[model samples]
Structures are given as structure tokens and as C-alpha cells.
Target: MCRWTRQDRQRSHPLNIQRDEYARRRRQLMRMAGEDAVLLVAAAPERIRNADATWPYRQDSDMHYLCGFPEPDSVLALLPGRKHGEVVLFCRERDPEHERWHGESIGTERAVELHGMDDAFPIDDIDDILPGMIEGRGRVYCHFGSEPEFDARLLGWMRRLRQLRGGGVVPKEFVALGHLLHDLRLYKSRGELKLMHASANIAAEAHLAAMRMATVGRHEYEVEAELMRTMRSRGAVAAFPPIVAGGVNACTMHYQANRAPLRDGDLLLVDAGAELDCYASDISRTFPINGRYNREQRALYELVLEAQLAAIDEVRPGRAFDAAHQMAVRVIAEGLCALGLLAGTADDVIADGSYKRFYPVKTGHWLGLDVHDVGDYRVDGEPRMLEPGMVVTVEPGIYIPPNDTTVAERWRGIGIRIEDDVAVTRSGNDVLTANVPKDAGEIEAWLKRGMS
Candidate 1:
């Protein structure tokens, strides 16, 4: 078996995000917001993990997408064609005492020098100052309800500005910033793709490690620990809480309680990802607890893999957003009917949603910075067409819960999901998490040989 040390993990990944990348993103967003518009985006607020302690602060995805400033209690206001500057940042001020206890502050002075901001101000004066910036704008493109407290404050600013309309101009229009901003973010840049590729490779290694360590007697959390160690050792954090569901536990979507004991003949489904440099890669794999799968387990696993592969084929440019999901549903429904899990024809099962008994939700979702990343799958309530540069997950699953008496006893209590992160290209799709094997035969060989 191959042993991976933290030093090895450290050397495997390098960050590629440059300062200019964020600046370009800001310029792109400004183009979306016209000359007379002001786009207000707030930083993610601090939360109390416990008394006096705080949760690990992560910047808002939209805010971070435009400006790569990684501090808290900050806001970015982009005013195109403004006299002084286009990018104005409001952030915490420099306090020697506070810095001594907590950490360094990206004071207003350095915000302009280091982060390319046109002008900067202390967050202390936001209420008095931000409204002035908001005044005389034709359109206010802002995240209206992301931060409720900030939302109320913004409303107050708008109300106060409305009162002063005798001389001052309040924004005549309020447009949701996400509509335009998310669309910009939906397409990945070269830097973003590089980060996502690294994330996916790291996650693939973690999954292989988990598979190698898993045994009949080991607990689900024990396997989860292996995954965490592998990711953190590589300096990437999990995109989300891992779903290390074993046997019947796998039937529950979004299963978090990973304390179940691994059974000798049961399947262990692992759904996890690594987030490298704020870019996320999500992948899922299902394998037997022991080295190899049993007869019935292999049969069901192969069916899911078939559906997932067929779905991935739909992840190409000009295809509809739901094309992959529709493909997966058709394949899964047909496979189930052929296997006698469903009696009706594939078309009948799909039309009546009889396949929901085994397959519950759509195949997968968009994958990026946030796990369920920002992007509209629909425009004008119609399915949006998939385009080049969009990354999506192709996950098709079948869960036969233990209590459900619909299926045969052999088929019940078996759940399987195979997923991979695919980036849509002009010609086809690129699988970011391809290093991780979803095929039963390949997974068994890898597990037995250990990262060969």
C-alpha cells in the first residue's frame, strides 16, 4: 500500500489566482452594469460559533468573484465612469491595539494601493458615506436580501435618499445584482479552471485513500477521517460535509450521520469534494465495503454508472440545462424496467414519475466556488441552454430504502450514486474528477492495488 505523508500532499497543489484576475472580473461586471449604475455587494457577516468565538470567515462568493479581498466587515461599490475612481471599498480601519490582539486589517489606505480600489473608507463611516455614493444613480444593482441587516440599512438609505430627491437623485431602479453577476461567474476563467482541476485531483486522491482504508469492521466516520486527512494535508478543505453513507444509510440523501458500522457485503457510498483556492470540485463514488462487490450489488452499481455516463454525454455546449438530467432519467428508467424493478415501459415510468421510487431528484447541479454554485438554470421560466465554460455535476442515483416493500428483498436496502464534475467545452465536456474511478471493476482493482 502507498503511504501519503502531509509533505507529499503539500507539494502536490499550487495556487494560480493572480490579482489581475479579480480586476478583470470587476471590469466584466461593470460592463454588465451600465455607466450610470452603482453595484453594491456586501461581505459575508461574522457569525458566532460560540460565545466570543467566531466561525471561520469566508467572503461572499459574488463579492469575492469581483474583488479578491478576503477580509470581513467590508463592502465593494463599483461606480463606472465615476470621476474619482470606479472601484470603492469600505472596510475596517487600522487600529494598532486591535491588530495586536486579533490580526492585521486591510486599512483603507492599503485597500487602494494593494487591491486596486479607486477610493477607500473606514467601515465605521458606511452609514454616513455609502448613501451619498448611492445617490444620483440611475440604477442600483445590489444583493437586496442576502444580508437582512444590510438589506434593512439599504432600504433606509433608499428611503432617506427619496426624501432628499428635491436636490439629490435616488436610484430610479433596483435590479438584482445576482442576475448579471452570477451569469458572469457561471463561466470559468483559465485561473478558475486551474483551481478547480487541482481541487478535483485532490478530491480524487482522498477518495482513493478512503477506499483503501475501508474494511468490513471499520466505521463510516473512520473512512471519513481518512478523506479529511487527505484533503487538509493537501491544504484544501471539503466543499461540504462528506456523505459517508453505508448500506441502508445511503438511501437518505444528504446523510450526515456517518457513525454506522460497515457491513461485510454492503455498499459504502462516498460523496465528497475538495475546495482549492475557493474553487470547488464535487465527486461521488460507491463501492463495496469489502474489496469486491456481490452479485446483486454489482448489478445495481453498473446500472447507475450506465445512467451517469449517458448523462455526462449530454454536458456539451448548446444543450439545454436539464439535458443531462433528462438523459439520466431515461436511461435509469429503462434499466429499472429491464431489471424488473419497474413493470411499465421506460416512457411510461418517466411520464408517470413511477421511477421516483428509486430515483428521487434530478441527476445533479452546477459546481463551482459554492457547492451548489451560482447560476440560473432557467431564463424567463424556460430552461436555459448550456454553454461553453459552464461546469456541472453528472450524478445519477438509485436508492431503495429498507422500509419500502415495493422492490424485491434483494434489491431493497441498496443505494448507489456515481457523480463527476464536468466542464462543458466547445466540442464536448471535460471530466474534472476523472481520476476517481466510478466503475466497479476499476474501483476494485484500485482498492486492492492502492493508488497504482
Candidate 2:
């Protein structure tokens, strides 16, 4: 039975986002204002994947951060430095015609009650009501260059305000709200950490299920099906298109053409994630299709695993954001030299950029609401230091192409990636997805246990 039904979704617990959080964020925005600053954030619209087929609806990250409301066609307005300076949500009204085709629509009253907004109004009245909301505001803070439609609407709003400038009503400045919100989202709250941990657990279970279900002669899509099924069964959704690559295809990053059949001697890379309550957990694991790694595959897998472990160890509060990447690069360089993939010494190979031949991508990236979550790692042209409550992925891989003649035939067509979600802490790093097996021996044991 599917655990992610509409009923289950409705019964889900409300996130514990206090009203003070929104008040605090608004205060911070108001502090940046030269005069009256009004911030506007819009919710994401449901996109159509094809004719009459719509993609799963997910709330905008900024909107979710402010109100925790998941409904579509919603807009949040914040008039900072005012007596009533709080959130006001503009949302869809209940209509039987649209409600019959789509699911239920939470009207403005319910939106205000459920989301703790100061006030609410029907979305259809946005054109008539928004100008009044912006009449006395001196600065209009919104996400510019984000949505062309919204940009046009903003221009029209400003034009309307300009037309009424004879009445002494016009915004003096326009600023991008993304700058402020992005900085705020860099640090996770306790509630966010709880949701992120839940997401990581779901991803871990799904990956383990895929590992156990894998076997020789099975198609890559079959493994993907198992992963999706496991995730859905656990009341979660995929964060992104799961990558199930086998043999030579594993070397292709972002490989989604999961149509190839698994070969007995080939390696399989599954880069998948589970989204729980809109929080994302990204993890990648590579193992043999037949449940036992050969000599060359084991060597490369161990190397990548070693590099990943070293990178994870470097994750700590106050460390530079690039410290883990540098650590992983050093480990990869040393491993490549040991495997004879590079000719020179470790330092020389790293200095000459020979490491890129094997490790092309970065070691990892920040993980959260989006698969590659938002946050500026560098501020003022310097690396931003890691802080507690920040979640990130540590993924390291070595891909040896099938056509590369520099290596032996047995070593070709092997790609291995080991990924896990890590949360930086004052004490150390917490491996959120540690429940999933990664060690080569444990993976083999899991396969054996499944067969038994």
C-alpha cells in the first residue's frame, strides 16, 4: 500500500515553526532598509510535465521558510519597520469548479489560521490590493530576474504606483530579496534539522533496499523501481531523478538512462535521495551487481571510500568551506598515484591538475530544501566557514572509462561513488544516513543475507 496518500498528507504533523521566527526574519530585513522596505515572495506554481499531466507540487523554498504553507499561487508580503510589519499571505479562494478537477483548496481564512499569518486575502484581488500594500513603502524588495512573469507584474505595479506619484506615493528603491533570504537559509534551525534527519533516514532505507534487490542480469530501471517504491512506501518522495547507472554508464554523472542490463562483473552506481516534508537527503552508493567486487573494482572503490572518509572527517564548525574539498582532493591524488593512474608524485599530480582526469567533480555540496540547496559559500571573496546546523553531502567517486587504454581492460568500465549526508557540529560531524551500509564487506553480507 502506498503510504503517501492525500489522507496521510493531510494528517501530517504541522512543522513547529514559531511565529517569532517570521518576526525575527522580518526584523532582519527591516534593518537593511534605508527607509520603508516591503518584501514580497511568491509560491511556486504547479508545472505540467505533459498534456494533462502535472508534476508533483512543491512549495517555494522562500515561501516555505516564511510561512510553512504548501499551497500553490500564494504570495507573502512583509512591510518591515511598521506597527503591522509581519507576514500577509495572498492565496486561492475556494471554488467548486476548480476544486472538482484539482484537490481541495484552502481559502484565505484557513490559510491565515493554519499558517499564522497576520492577514490574508484572495489571490484574484492581488492586482487591486498590492498597490495599496506598496503605496507608502519606499523600497520594494522582491526576487528580481527570478520569474519573468513576476518581473513584468512588478514593473506594472511600479508603473501603477508611478502614475499615482502626484498623490505622493512611490517606492524609492527596489532590492532583491534573495540576498537576505539566501543568507538566512544557510543556517538550519532545530526544526529544520529534525526534518532533514528524517529525510536522510528515508534515503538510507531506500538505498539499502536497492542494494539488497540488485542482482546480475537485472535492468537498471528495475533497481530504480525498487528505490522509488521503497521511498513511496515510507511516505516520502524523490528529491530528484534517481540515477541508476551500470557498467560504463556509471561513469556518466547525472546518468538517468537506466535502461542497460546489469552485468555480473560490472559496478552499479545509484545516486538517489528521498524528500520528507520537503527536506531533501541525497546519497550515492556503488556496488557490484553480483554482490562481490573484483580485485580492480575493490581497489578503486576502497580509494574512493578512503577519500570520502577523509572528507567527512574534515567537516566541523569554523572550518573553511573548501577545507573538505581540499582534503578529498589530496586523498584522491594519493590514491591515483598508488593505482598508477597518474605518473608523478601526489603533490606533482595535484599541482599539474592530473587529478581531474579521474575526479572531475567536486567532493560534495550543501544539501537541504533543494537537492543542491541555496547558500553563498563565499562572502566578500573569501571562503565562508562552516557552522553548526549546516547539512552537506560528501560524495567522492572515481570513474575509469571503458575506452581508456591507459588502464587495463579489467579496470575499465568501473565507476564507484560513495555519498552520505553529513551535519556539521561543535563536537564533530553526524552521519545522518549512516544506517545504510557502505563498506564493501557489509554490502556483500547484506546481499548474501537477502539471498538466504
Steric clashes per prediction: 0, 0
RMSD of 1: 4.5
Candidate closest to the true structure, highest lDDT: 1
Model 1 earns a TM-score of 0.94
TM-score of each: 0.94, 0.95
Q: What shift in Å separates residue 365 of candidate 2 from its native position after superposition?
A: 0.8
Off by over 4 Å in 2: 1-11, 14-35
Per residue, candidate 1 scores C-alpha lDDT tens digits across 76-108 of: 999988888889999999899998887667789
lDDT by residue (1-452, candidate 2, tens digit) is 65453623543656545556756666676577534778898888788999989888898888877777788888888876456636688899989899798867778887767667778899888887788778887788899887788789888877776666476388888887877777778788887888888888888989988987788888999999999999999878999999999989998988989999988888889999998877899999998888788999898988888889999998998888888889989998998898788888999988999788788998888888888999987879998889998888999898888898987788887888999999988798899999988888988888888767
Question: Where does candidate 2 clash, by residue pair?
Answer: none
Clashing pairs in 1: none
lDDT, model 1? 0.87
Tell me the spans in candidate 1 whose CA falls farther than 4 Å from its real position: 1-14, 159-167, 450-452
lDDT of the candidates, in the order given: 0.87, 0.84
